[model samples]
Target: MKARTRTNLWFQLALVLTLGTLMAWGPAVPVQAQDVVVKVGNIIPLSGPSASVGLQGKQAREMAVEEINAAGGIQSLGGAKLVMLYADSESKPEKGVAEAERLINTEKVHVLTGCWNSAVTYPVTAVAERYGIPFIVPVSVADKITEQGFKNVFRIAAKDSWWTRDQFAFLKDLQEEFGTKVSKLAFVYENGDWGKGFAEQWKKLAAEQGYEVVLDEPYPSTATDLSPVVQKIRRARPDVLMLVSNAADAILLTNTLAEYKVNLKAVITSGGGHADPSFLKAAGENARYLFDIVEWETDINKPGAQEANAKYKAKYGQNLTGEAVDAYLAMYVLADALERAGSLDPAKIREALAATNYRSGPGMIVGYDAVEFDETGQNEHASLVMVQINDLGQGLERITVWPKGARRAGYTPVFPMPAR
Candidate 1:
């Protein structure tokens, strides 16, 4: 045979061998379309006032799902990938309920999560319970959410009552640490289930601590101008101001407080708005010396936390907030349950979630050690860390400063925030 013909024959033999090897490898593991898809319905305030945090939660979930899928997905289900289907609650309880109904009946999502507003989550829980769908709440801290006697609802964050309890404990510690007395207390919050819930506990705790409640103010979260509320806080003459606000209002309240020069020993804020990624930038100097309670902060001592935050910041153009962290971890928690359940049945998934004691993983970057759920479907290990917003010579950042042990090393908390 000619040289060209011999060369052609050799190439054909090699091509045949390659094709045989590929066939023996079992069809190249199939395409994504052939893999099982686990649909997770996420209901959140994608519009209106809570949009910023809602967007953060969405981004976090997407990142986690992408990672989970990239890491071979759910092995037991033939490498099933999680598919997130989102519905906007618009911060309305009715809208949340309606969206929950649509996501369940129409989208046929196996698991449900979110509706960040506690009011929305409160009612959405019933809908999930009625449908026998497991609803994993990432950061909605309403006690009523887990207290509703529903087997399908689980919360991954400390409840509002727990938050309030910690707030007062921190206050006691604050007074002892600095040798400063905090006599008068003020409660300012959004007039919603979440804010009202926190305020109710604050009142009881204040009374128990023998601290006089100087002001109890609840304002609309949609209020464009918070000067009136700031004026009330200024006039209340409280030593410390406790706040529970969403993102927009959190910024508005902080700016207004600074603009009006509200004098107070310190400002303690719940994590929602105060923990927002954009809060420091939007509030600027006004957010300084503010103490906020959260489940996770950028300065946490956990392993992999800084790396995760760095990766997230590179992807999302902002550091991970507590809300973002919870949402991110919720995806991992759900992925864990799905892995163990080994089935798509909601009942099996629910059983797996109820028994979860997730200890270590990329998602375990939270301050807590584990993600164990109590009988009430609350993560017993879920706890809050108090972070002070200050410039540690690096612009403004949240520095963990509570529980004493977890406090950032070599950083002294500024109490009785200096006057502007």
Candidate 2:
């Protein structure tokens, strides 16, 4: 009887052990999937004066996200999908801050991008830094945005100083080519961060270059008529006219110039004015003979650039705007950083981004190698290109690259200065 009882006890113990082992490593039980979603945020002006440009950026970003996801997602992170959330800042700084807060606190995005205007971008970047999110600035040109010394913020586009420097270099080349002195210059800009920042840079550079700035005018962004400003420029009668306005105001100024027949030897604009295709459509023939300093070219379809351009055209059913190109490049940069990091952790992504030095989509070779941050988190070596809007209103033709002596010399001027 004792032997039999011992045998039963052993059998019960073995059965319990077997059941526990099965429960611990059972085929019926499911394993949880790894977290494979990267959240990115965007703050852009979707329903404001700069909406035309902002919309293009928003579309480009969405397209890039879709493409990246379609290609088996992010391969470096076990095929993780990129999720994007966007907020319309309405081109207002205050609204940008609020949206940025929402994106950070509520949405809990890992990275932040977008904001077309410098005014909106400037404030939104601050919020991004406050929350320790990596912010990639695509289109804002204010020097201070990068100069603020935030380690988490990176801008792919040129600053205001760079733009002015490029513009001055182009002007010098034009002066040498035409044998005409660009001594007396007139400056007209909107009364905003972009306008003020660029205008100040131009003024300082003009002084350094020994060019005489005859007249300087700052108009309201909401100004209905630019006739008074046009008249002021006409009266100044400077050798060259430099306009710094957003697309809508740019249209207004151009229309005024055409209607009033303000004949000047040369009309040049900073990037914002004539960079968008809407400028050509709005100004029509008036846009002829106007020169603009731009960051990207519609032509010169380099390998990757051509592919991006084709994709943009296919998706939008029209040519991609400059802002769109920047947005696309921004996504490409983020993707490269994520791949290099091999993880989605914000700190790791930031480290990888600082080490990024790859060719962007097209028209850009990012110098992310040693992207050491100044106190303001701005990349010190950012550059700009000088693009001349041709009479045909197609892609901006490359006239000069920034940092003196880097221009394509002896190219025939597509939009030459009117006979003086």
Collision pairs in model 2: 148-376, 149-375, 149-376, 149-377, 150-376, 150-377
Q: Native-vs-model 2 lDDT? A: 0.75
lDDT of 1 at 43: 98
How many clashes does the backbone of model 1 have? 0
lDDT of 1 by residue, 1-420 (tens): 699999999999999999899878753555454557999999999999999999999999999999999998898888999999999999999999999999999999999999789989999999999999999999997678898789999899877778888888888999999999999999999999889988988998888879999999999999999998888888889999999999999999999999998889999999888888899999999999999997777888776788989999999899898789999999999999999998878999999999998988989777667898998899998878888999978899889888675677788899888877
How does candidate 1 fare on TM-score? 0.71
Instruction: Give the per-residue lDDT of model 2 (tens digit) for 200-303.
Output: 98899888988889898999989888899988987887888998888889999988987877767778888666766577777777776677776665553234
Q: Using TM-score as the measure, which candidate wins?
A: 1
Predicted model with the maximum lDDT: 1
Error of 2 at 288 (Å): 3.9
What value does the lDDT take at residue 181 in candidate 1? Answer: 97
